[model samples]
Target: MNTVKIGWIGLGKMGIPMSQHLVKAGYPLNVYNRSKDKEDAFKAQGIGSAASPAELIQHTDVVFVMVSDDKAIDDIFTGENGLLKPEVSGRVIINMSTVSPAISKEMAAKCIAQGNHYLDAPVSGSVKQAEDAALVIMVGGDATAFEQVKPILEKLGKLAMLVGDTGAGNTAKLAINTLLGIVAQGLAETVTLARQNGIDAEALTTLLNNSALGSPLIKIKGEAIVNNNFNAAFALKYIAKDLRLAKDMGADTPLAQTAYKTYQDAEAALGEEDIIAVIKHLG
Candidate 1:
């Protein structure tokens, strides 16, 4: 792992911590971010900085991307400085963004045509999990490429499973996120109903945490909802985006559809808040 030359694109919430883990694990790290400050910050830590994705590709054997959406991914990899440019080949590009599986398939095809390897490996976790290197990563694409990077990925996640062929990772991620959106909404509604019926919000939250219904997500988000701490661990807008993608993919997601609208409404008022802030839309 230490001998692998790794490059990272995207330096947002999850990206920053995930990349930090790679650097700490002693992989030869290079990074590029559209924001100069983020790039410079990593450079100051002794990691190499690339002027663009094209340049980053020149120096690294594997490039990991954790950008926001399909548009962002396209912007970084389709322009003059794009990763798919003629000069970039024979490298592994691992996309860890939660995006449409269709888009992932398209990108994988393009990369493979250019003599590159692509893996759609999106993670299931929030900022805390990223920081603690406890994320669960779902991967797809060539089994050989997956094995090559499995050791590196393990340094950033507790579990890394190759779900299927290209785009399957994104499919799995969307499926998991659908459950996340629905459960989050359910928890929000349940807590709000308890408060409305004159039950103590904090006590109800504690009771739920100690019950079989308790999950790590419910326990963490439940505390946030009760205390009204809406600081973003995972932004509500991103959750809304994932739900929208799930809908676009024909998932028959009625519950996710309702949860999507709830998140969209909450985003209008608390766009930058934690996903748990969807509780604010309750009652």
Candidate 2:
């Protein structure tokens, strides 16, 4: 077994279960979260908790960060108490957060300048999937760094791969999410419309399940419409955030602008819910 001692940042819905899988796999982990109580799962799993990023940096081999966004990524990696302080060298930072490709590029530069390695490794899966260790992971970084971290990543996901470099993975994730948002919103609108026309959504869903457009995206997510439960596996706020990123991408491609507007409209309709609930905006 590769004794790469573990370090993780963030402990949200996704982070908690992933950390559980890490410790259960018997890798020594030192985890840190901004909110103290968020660190409970790590502690419960016998993984050590750090009072701050600096302390956490002091204790591990590779640090896996599943933080919120670019700002949080900056604060943790380059903040005063950031892990990439002048003194620390030879550490690897794996970001599992979905961030802008530009930011990922900048982060890679900072890590290299500071003699550390950085990898952008985002994932696709709901919280339940995360708990079950079945997420599809996309990685981009220095090949050696990815090789070093691949084994640890395996503990957190079922499918994992190093795509291109630094920002490539983030770009891929954004593209994938953008399409998902479109289809999910499309599903939401189609069903809601069919219902308004006196068609039973359940029956429409049954038919769609066998149609060419029958995608697992609809199969798994169309149920959210059938049952008005919108507890987030992927939150509305985050999808809105992603569309904002899409808008940036839109500068180069107008379609992205339309998608951003779509997400904005969706966010307006449903203040907050699972991302799939964006369909609620269709009415």
Candidate 3:
């Protein structure tokens, strides 16, 4: 069993299952979530809970954060009773949240100055991939620190690669999510076009699945579109947020711009729904 004491600071849809892998791997883990119910849930499962991020870091060597956006990232690491508050040193703080590269760089600098290592290690894949430990993690930070926690990261994802320096993971994530928006929008428009021209949703999806252009995302989102199941696996709003972040990072291509606007327009109505629900906005 890897003996690095672990601390996890988020317990949302993705965070819960991702952290579970650590506990199951016997990493001597402790968790801290803003919601007491989630902490209680982990505690009930024989995992440990801490009252705050500061408290959690006191006893752990490696801390993983998987919150929502940049604001949440700010609050988690620098808010009241945050991780950097306790005068701790040598702790590897890995942020796996989908956030802006700028914020990740800011946090990395702060953590490094305080003698802690910070890695922007955001992941690609949704709740299902997280549950299955099949996520593709893109990491950025100190090489030594990455090698130190590689094994723990492996327990959470099928592939974990260090893409570059401090904010590179978030950069890669934004780029990937920008493509995700473009692809999802394309899929939504294709299904809409086929359905309008007398091709049944299932029939078109089947053809697409067998075609050379097919992919796991196309297959899965195609099924969701066929069944009209708009329930979120990856919420449309998050993708919209990512697109905006990408725009800020200079993703100014025609497809990127169009997809950003498409998702933004859909945000008001279908934002809470699955990203594939962009199809609904078409009508």
Candidate 4:
């Protein structure tokens, strides 16, 4: 099979490594980032760079976007230098951002109307999983389009599941993030309670990791909390955003609402820190 030409927009924490994976897989890749420094870095690595989304779409069969939020998504598709030009016809645009399901469906409709394919393929992983290409991708769009892009997605993730028609991927993503936020809050509160009662935080984490409650996230983020390492693997601000999206989805999300409040306070103080930094809010 011929290698599919790939174009990528957004070179944030996850996007950088994802695009690098495509380049490593020997696919012809072109990249565009709003930041010139990131675009220049891609150029240094011998990957091509485009001035705009429209420019990027012209050169590739598939375009992957991993922007920040719904507003950023809107800007990329409808901005002056957007990708919805006439030449985008027949191209596949896979949006891997975590946005509202409503926006995903609307964008999918627009892309289809313009004779292009759209996939709302949000991912489940942090910086480590992204770097290791171990993400679980939930994809929603045309089944044929999903099949066509499976190989490409596999280069960036361990598993890619086509959940349903357009917007389902984002719906699934929001659900997963809701659980993640709740778990993170639970872990944070547990750690704080332990620390306050004179128990060693790291020992508590070790105990948890050895217990039935242990999980990859608990072990990893629990360790981060114990060590007080608040680096941005998945920033608190982003998770707060996801929580808000989940709340707005019209579900009876009391637990998620509580977690949302916790994250919101954490984000106010340590927005740029990792989601694990929510523990800091307990003090």
Leading candidate by TM-score: 3
Candidate 3 vs 4: which has more TM-score:
3
lDDT of each: 0.90, 0.82, 0.92, 0.90
Note each model's CA RMSD in angstroms: 1.2, 1.8, 0.9, 1.2
lDDT of 3 by residue, 203-281 (tens): 9999999999899999999999888899999999999999999999999999999999999999999999999999989
lDDT of 4 at 136: 100
Looking at model 2, residue 116 earns an lDDT score of 86
The digit string of per-residue lDDT tens for model 1 on 63-133 reads 99999999998887887888877567889999999999988889898898889999999999999999999
- True lDDT of residue 114, candidate 2: 76
Q: After superposition, how far is residue 105 of candidate 4 from its true place, in Å?
A: 1.0
Candidate 2, 28-139: lDDT as tens digits: 8888999999777567756689877878887887888998788998899778888877457789988999899988899889888878898999998878789999998999
- Please identify model 4 stretches exceeding 4 Å from their true place: none
Whose lDDT is greatest here?
Answer: 3
